[model samples]
Target chain A: MNGLKNDGISEIIDGKRVIVKKPELLAPAGTLEKLKIAVRYGADAVYIGGQEYGLRSNAGNFTFEEMKEGVAFAKEYGAKVYVTTNIFAHNENIDGLEDYLRGVGEAGVTGIIVADPLIIETCRRVAPNVEVHLSTQQSLSNWRAVKYWKDEGLDRVVLARETTGEEMRLMKEKVDIEIETFIHGAMCIAYSGRCVLSNHMTARDSNRGGCCQSCRWDYNLVEMEDGAEVAITQEGDSPFAMSPKDLRLLQSIPGLIELGIDSLKIEGRMKSIHYVATVVGVYRKVIDAYCADPENFTIQDEWLEELEKCANRPAAPAFFAGTPGADEQLFGVHGKKASHDFTGLVVDYDKATQMVTLQQRNFFRPGDTVEFFGPNLDTFNQIIGTVVDEDGNELDAARHPLQIVRFKVERPVSKDDMMRKGL
Target chain B: MNKPELLVTPGSVNEIKKQIEAGADAFLIGEQRYGLRLAGEFNRQQVKEAVALAHEHGKKIYVAVNAIFHNEIANELDDYVAFVKGAGADAIVFGDPAVVMAVRETAPGFPLHWSPETIATNYYTANYWGKRGAVRAVLARELSMDAVIETKEQADVQIEVQVHGMTCMFQSKRPLLGHYFEYMGKSMEIQKRQGTQNMLLHDAERSNKYPIYEDANGTHIMSPNDMCIIDELQDLVEAGIDSFKIDGVLQTEEYRIETTKLYRKAIDLCVDQPDQYEEEKEGMLEAAEALQQEHRPLDSGFFFKETVY
Candidate 1:
């Protein structure tokens, strides 16, 4: 296998052999490191945010320098980078946005995803070289909205999470444009940009990037009676939490491919590197497997297991099949812990010394069994026999966060490989 | 012409006549099935009456044909647009391109106002939508006063800003309140596709209670504070905003009428004698403050920098 991942599937179109190559696997990258991991693990494209003008204000967004570096890294695997400028702009927020957008274009970003028309117009005026895609925050549920954006020169529109399966099919039939949908990760209980619970309660504008996720917080039902506020419903039976389970669409890969969707996106920008690699890798493998052989290929059990291992929150299918009801609404606060603990990230492998160097992400003790896996290599189980620091002193456990640790390994593991232990 | 046109949301055709008498220059009305988040969903016959009443009074009536159409809704919209236009509606306010197409195809010369709740943030988008056929743009409530003024100054189309109303912070097609009730194993009657007065959501950790209701368009989670921007009317009038909207979604018909009259007095005072705005605003504020529920305090949303963040 090539070190750089092959992004598209092979297929025939218009009676000729045109690899039925789309439903592009788009991943989210919070930092430059995550961008590299996404490209290597098998993303056709990665959407990221710059330092400003994004909904994820708290995410470790890239600066222009990091964005340029990230773009160059993604280019090695023939992957594309699109920066997110998806904030609902306030008056002050508009200051210096044109220049920021121009800088994104200069960094060779393939496109910019925005929800505001102001950003679209500015990009078209000053950064004409960059493509523009509409963010899902616009809550585009119908074909006309899709067609509307297309009329205004947008390349694609990320369909709202509330977009029903029937609506998606109708949109594809009615509009001739690239359609993207969120297939996995956290789902907003409110339609993406249609929400500002964080803004109202915390005074942090969810639209302008400071979303505190107030919907996930508990609420008590009340009503006004006799011109006085009355508490009609108490929070006891089940908490009045508005958070939904994280989205998982492993079962719907073939349907999306058949639908001719241009891109299948995962929604997480503030997630871990372990999450970026694990989720991207699973989706990539499943998409490839289904594309390679449509009829015989079934969702292997291992893929679901792999998905379950990395879920920092409980995952489910939302509003994809039909209008979800009580089953879809999560009325509790607890996010599911990762089934497996990510122990380390492989930094370098020395064949001469037969040792693998890594930066510790989680604690690992001697005799702890770990599995080493990479984008291009088959996963192999390894026992933590002896761990040594960079100064060559033996250690009982790799405890400090991101501390460099080395151990003897006969198999040749490449850089960016991950090591994990089942919790 | 110096003062912005005062637009009011009337609960019915009868209220349209009453509100016009109370000093509204225009009316926003529609059938419950067509308009997404309206206070009153007038039926077809009522819609016809509304158009006639507004026309008879020399006032404007704009129908809300702004649902995000699925194929079924899209297929039905062309006939609906024609019906409203045939009834002599002044303009059609819509957010979706489907409705845009309907208005374009059915009523070629019908005035269009692109009023997507959150997307119309900047002048560029407003100008772009103007090119697509919106004669006027209803700016998002999220915009600050500076942004609003900039949009009014720079955009090709006329601009309308909500001067007084409730702001919907969240909307979803899923019957969130119904499901939230079901999840709690507590059954409560939630009126669908219409306004309900009894339901409110209180943050368990905090002390804000947001009024929430479900409709055909979806569940709308309104902001806890009543967005009362009557105090900002002078700035809007001075900025030359084409229209001022008073959304009466959850308020009483009397509150709607009273508020409309207060804004009428306020706008007239500002447009007539600009120097008296501060003096006149006190009486306006006294009346506006009286209407406020103690629990649901009034704040001028997003106009000031503190709330804009």
Candidate 2:
């Protein structure tokens, strides 16, 4: 094991010992159910937001009670929960912040992620017991920022998404605090939430979690000439010049582990439970496999295939490899469709009748062939033999969102196993 | 009531004294190294001379070091901060927390102003900065009058809101303009003619056009309408705001001089005739209407309606 110390557990694989350094796999959770799914799928930690002050304001954000339940549920799986209060505070935003901070602290959350300096100071004072992780919104791209935050006594600093793996290694060499970076998710065209295009176009505040995604709008490159306007036409459909491809850094896991990054973050708080489970499960497998043996580490094509099946735009290795250019820019399109549609989620399973109660997400019919997968189970395809509502009335299709519906299957599925319509 | 101070951005070093003579109470300027606006950056010598000129007229000057900094140049920043502090700058306007922390460490008692690129929409954030040693918080340009008033009422820190000027709606750290030029195969040395500082960029799907400019801090796309709230000086005064900013670094000298003088007149009238300020407000509004550029649009941005969405 080159540079791999024995701090990791040794396991016998093919009658040989392998040492593994397992970093925490942190995932994003938009709701309490997603939080449960993420934890069950082997996420060591999950970052979420409360009703107020989270950047994903429109998300089914947790209330104080929900946050308490989430913390307790995650604690059962030995995972941590971090809450976001990362909005840049204006003058009036401070009045009830202390109370919220105190409540979150008392709720036994692992940490609080904040962007504003004053917010960090307030958090330290009001919720001294809770750890404070610097939000990526701070756009901390330098070692000095990391050192400055560490010297100020912050527990961890989530490095900006734009940091290269080389810079990360250098930063880790300089600072002794926990380092977290976005390993996967939708990348912001603007510098990590430092955008106001949404605010000026619509009344939605992007910093306050109301991103209108103005960057993804179809745009034209135009120039002014002689008091007249002319279009800079290209050989394509309308150019989405500002839209960056979603980031997926599955290939760089060994390098990131060698640098000893404290946590690897996945960024999808506003996604469905199926998306969370699929993404977190994939990352967990890859990291664990890599940790078991570094010298023989190999990038698996199956992991990428599984990720492509979830709700995502086309994925590209972002700035981690280098400063992304036209290759990383999405052109002529706003978003790409996933390979499969998330149909439903397993809520309850009656082994005797082979009936599974599910919360329908997308439209699916009685004869649709769907695949079911969870934390401990391999994906298995099952034909939906019958579909009925809560009152046992037969339905042609499960059309509504979050509607309670039951379907007959051949085998029992665990709670939280995601169901997706096969292509 | 005290007259609200007028802060102006001069187009050039020579324009500084003239803007002060036109009744500019203070100056918010920047150097070429770390300032937000690339076109308005003053050399170090000009910065020192400008400070002397402002102080000669009994005015305050704040230097803007508000660019989002990267780690490669982190050491250079400490020297830059020390240089600005030693060069007699009254205060430094910073947006990055790391830079603010550096300043706090370098000059523990220096007057530091927090200018987050994102709007500080509420009072709690300002109070948070106030307790952390920030003397002033410039309210975000998108704030409605009600939010500004609430910020001033609730946050104990000094509040500064842009009352008149172009508002930067989008800022990015990527070298988008350079990249565009490269993509277009255009020469990098294209000489930009005067009066062409504002570049208009539009989307194919949307008819609205935005003004884009780039510098050391990266690209800044501005709102279409120039914010003109000189007519609402009394409302701002009543909201406990005393500092009004006018961004004219990209505007013509004539426009800068006229706008500064118009706000100066409006502030004096509001202080002198509080009960009948409406009469003075009409006169100032007429002055502003007369000073408008022929084809340029202007609006009272988020001033009347609540902008919290």
Candidate 3:
């Protein structure tokens, strides 16, 4: 409760008292600020992308300096950092591969997740100190593969999202290496990393991280009569047939923990700091709550509600219980618009003056009521009592984008706490 | 350099003879129980007959058990692998690691073809499997020419490339079509066209129409245009590609025979007249274009251009 660190759960293993091995809560960090927020909020580790070789090319990926700083910050907060080198490397990409690996290794990363064997081989050769975790793009769903990877010196394997809880338990019994599974995020319509739709359609290589998300695109059912497009199935609407609802496994945390899952991963490297704070914070609390009292614990509705505050499509437990049916898919729809607007992000908090400093992301009026919440802190309402600019001059409203603004608060707010007008 | 062998997938016993007559050097046959292609699957007797016929014609026959297996149904695989080997199959073409392990256990000496659907995109992966006892690596469809050339040069084991056919752009074990139909309040018992149920759909924004089909292996969303690399035969051969595969299970028997014949001519010209590749390229293009007719559209697909961002 004092900071990011939490006590591990105790249990009897092999007839002796031992730590029950609390699963690592993994979160995504698109930027350096997000990285800090993830660690502060509850993430035991954060996965991020470097300047090159990593997927999510469009995300605010870390430069070498940023990665070094991110690593140091995570280390200080007792969180591990894993870099993404999950791209399918081409011959043209061979030259820079070694340098990228070495740089990330030197930046204090715990591991690098990769899909290509060539990258794994190179990581073993050039940066042997850095552990290699197989990416889900490999679509490894069986025990033999996990066993093979464990024998092949891979430190961990991120199970494909298609793996069910029962399958996970079987895999756990078969392999000795760590198993990480995605607990939240967008789902791919195609098999994990084998998708060619994005590449053939948009020319962006999904393997190289230029996923245009062609799967989310609205598609009309067309009858090809002699290679000619015939009738459109739907009228005046983009029927998003391939789009899947964002994955939410909050309800399955206790089961995942009971099954001895090593890491519960949150998939969003291109999302915002607000997203990192909100999602990571909620998961952190849930994991901590479960670890405190596993037998008597149950998932709170507020945890799911807190996650919904972040802009995402309708959430579902995809391929978790079993192979999802029609009810699991988000057919004929884009995305469900977020109920709450992301207003601003707290940059600094001063306890002496009882003033919270923040950068405005959306417009907020001085008289509007706002809710303040962050990692490890309870949600509290605060009226915008005295709005001031960077110079501390009183202002009527904070309208400029990323404008530094401060306001007096009743309770002490911490950095990375989000400010929103609506509940 | 060895002349690249023309391997074709014959859907039925009838097409087996026709494909061989059309000059296919090898055949990829599937079984009704475990093969990825449900329609093209042969029964036990038919599989043995096809293997004997292939052997009698001095051609190789590889059996496909390439469907991704779930743990629920995985216990049935060992018996299947043993049956495939006992049936005198030349090799087992597969994608799943569990199946590979089963093949290793049941048919230790049986030649293994690492079906590229497992995403063997680089030479390291190809060689990794080769070291683990795989005889061939069927290269992934997503690789560019440069990557293919690099893999062929560096790979220690044999490598095969799918030269022509419908490329499966997406594959999942989930029943996407059933879900889609139920969601749309439509009946799943729609009539098949000419006894073949080919489902076609497209992105509303793009003009491309993707062909979709489902079987026991789940749904396969094929590329809008069928891949035609007849003109690229010489290039693929020169890149040290050992075997050339022509996908025919989704196609008609006549289409299979015609395409096999077409690729046979192209492969011979490339092998016999190595220096005349450019000169013969135009004629090959014309012949390949003629084979397209009015139904199948063709493209180089991920071979010529780097798949975009």
Candidate 4:
């Protein structure tokens, strides 16, 4: 599951970047494989959730065994792993928390990201070795709150997405603790952890693991008039949409790095491996490129294009610049799908024979040209001329999920190198 | 335990006296721009007047400077907090930590309540703020009875719980209502839409309509049911909860007074005469039930476990 060691700042890969600074590029790891992919793709650290106690109870989170393995895998790359126990603990959900905290800590996670003080104190008491990074659910917008947590022994604080550039600057100016900011991924329209739309509408407590994402659903705006309901917004032409576009701060990489932002976070734990790889790879490049030459850096079109291929919905810069206007919102109900399909990931490569051992993620024909991208090399497109099964039998298509095949692509490959349907 | 003070959020300066007369021990008042989810926000003159009136009546008033501060709002934050403290507010209930610093910088010795809306679930978190000089903690509305009692038992800080009002389900910084209006060919003053007696939102899948409005803080969507736990006041009182809040925003003056009076009577009876309160629990529940609007459903919110999930 591992390949080349991650000794960053070693050399410029294809003249793109030689890592210079240590601003963390934090990615979401929904599974152990995703954690491997995230690190292999150049994420400095990854955040994951356990089966319970995380906000995404259904996120197929890591078991303690899996958590240990993921932590070990990340350690191989010299990256840290953070487990989320970031739920507001109700009385019923509060019983086994200390034991759960001890389990994750023993699993070798570098830190625990939590919002509530009870968990923070509990973890610090039960497992003093594990660091505490306050979750964004705390909505700490200014330096004073960061100071409060810092004084209370917090190792770091993830600023609320509503925090503006000025707020971040002031926070950096005032607080000595590490500050993490959300630079990309889906934006919650409401203040994080302050919403209970699911609890009210569906009786599922959002504070505990059951978020129905009711914010994305459509609604009808109405007004009461003398016992008769009057429709304010109509159907067909409209939906009472409150969905904020996914956040994309690709252009602000330099500003964030220059502003002394300690960590840049991408939000989505339940996303695909392809997404984790592409996004982590892009940010890794952008952050590296900017750090390599602070004054002469500019975002490349190819990086933007790579990001577009993995975007699950239309995106905006979000509150990075300021509170976005009407354009920031997704007025209609439908979410935009990714433009390209993730076809395969490189499991192993035989440089002597110029063949790649691939695991299929989507259906791909033998004749299809797929574009391959990796953190260690420049992206190149190769036409898939022939596919053979593990037993060396010819196959028409690489169809089944996780299907193993060998294809002669005549290209250099890394273990976690990913490919998508060509443009 | 002084039978726990009755804290009510008044919608106007005029309602503070009425609330005190109706048996409220304290009222939460603040400027709307600096407060989130307040029923009535007062200007400088009104805030000063309300504080004096509450002091005159030998009751306390907590000023809410709890808005999630943007840079622009934060410019006046220190002054606003100092103004509230200068006005002799009993304490300032704040959601932003900036307000805590403001209190420290400009209003030293002023007791503060950390009301980061939600996320103050367990006792350690409450005490965490208490260690930082916070005198009280506003418990999140999602806590269960067992958790609430545990928090009260463990924390040295004053614990405040909401016993009555409509719970706010969602809030956003974007002017979503104005955007919807402009999405259509219409325009309206979004902030003025609050308390219009008409505006509501109907989820496409759900049949009940929710109260929806906009303010400087942003759009707010409320629960379909108005949460009334008058019958459960005894449980909290016996658990030694320091304060019980009755949310008076979006509620009428009549409804606010009636609900406040009932909660007052219930807390007193729950403390002084538990048996008589037990005998009168049904009639009190009915009175609170009668005060609710016909369109708004009334239930004990998150008080019972079976439905909390």
What tens digits encode model 3's per-residue C-alpha lDDT throughout B1-309? 679889988888788888888999998887645777543878888889998899999999898887666675566778888888888889888777777678767878778888856266777778877877788999878787778888899889898988888787787766766666667766443333223345577654666778776666666788777788778776678777899988875677787888888888888878888767658777876776777735457888778976656
Interface DockQ per candidate:
0.60, 0.40, 0.58, 0.60
Badly placed stretches (over 4 Å) of model 1 are: A1-19, A91-95, B187-195, B273-278
Residues A1-423 of candidate 1 have per-residue lDDT tens digits of 011122244455554433366579999999988899999999999999998898887889998999999989988889999999988775566789888988999999999998887788889889998989998888787777677777777898998887766677778787788999999999788777777676667777788887888777777777777778766565355555667888898888777776677899998998888989999999999988877666567888988988887897877778777777677767765587889999999999999998999999999989998988779878788888988999999999999999999998758999999999999
In terms of lDDT, which candidate is strongest? 4
Candidate 1 residue-wise lDDT at B288: 94
Across the candidates, what are chain A's individual TM-scores?
0.93, 0.91, 0.92, 0.93
Clashes by residue pair, model 3: A203-B308, A204-B308, A204-B309, A205-B308, A205-B309, A210-B309
**Global Cα lDDT for candidate 3:** 0.80
Badly placed stretches (over 4 Å) of model 3 are A1-19, A224-240, B37-39, B188-196, B274-284, B293-295
Clashing pairs in 1: A10-A19, A11-A18, A11-A19, A11-A20, B193-B215
Candidate 4 structure quality by residue, lDDT tens digits, B1-309:
468999998888888888888999998888778888787868989989998999999999898888887656766878887788788889988877777777778877789998876667778778878877799999887767877898899888999988788878888877888877666646664545644646888865678888888777888888788788877777788788999988877777888988989988998898999988899988999988887677887887876744343
Candidate with better TM-score, 1 vs 2: 1
What lDDT tens digits, residue by residue, belong to model 4 across residues A328-366? 788765577787899998999998998999999999998
Instruction: Compute the lDDT of residue A164 as modeled in candidate 2.
Output: 85
For each candidate, what TM-score against the reference?
Answer: 0.93, 0.87, 0.93, 0.92
CAPRI level of candidate 1: medium
Root-mean-square deviation (CA) per prediction: 3.9, 4.1, 3.9, 4.7
lDDT of 1 at A161: 86
Which prediction has more favorable TM-score, 3 or 4? 3
Interface RMSD values for the candidates, listed in order?
A: 2.1, 2.9, 2.4, 2.2
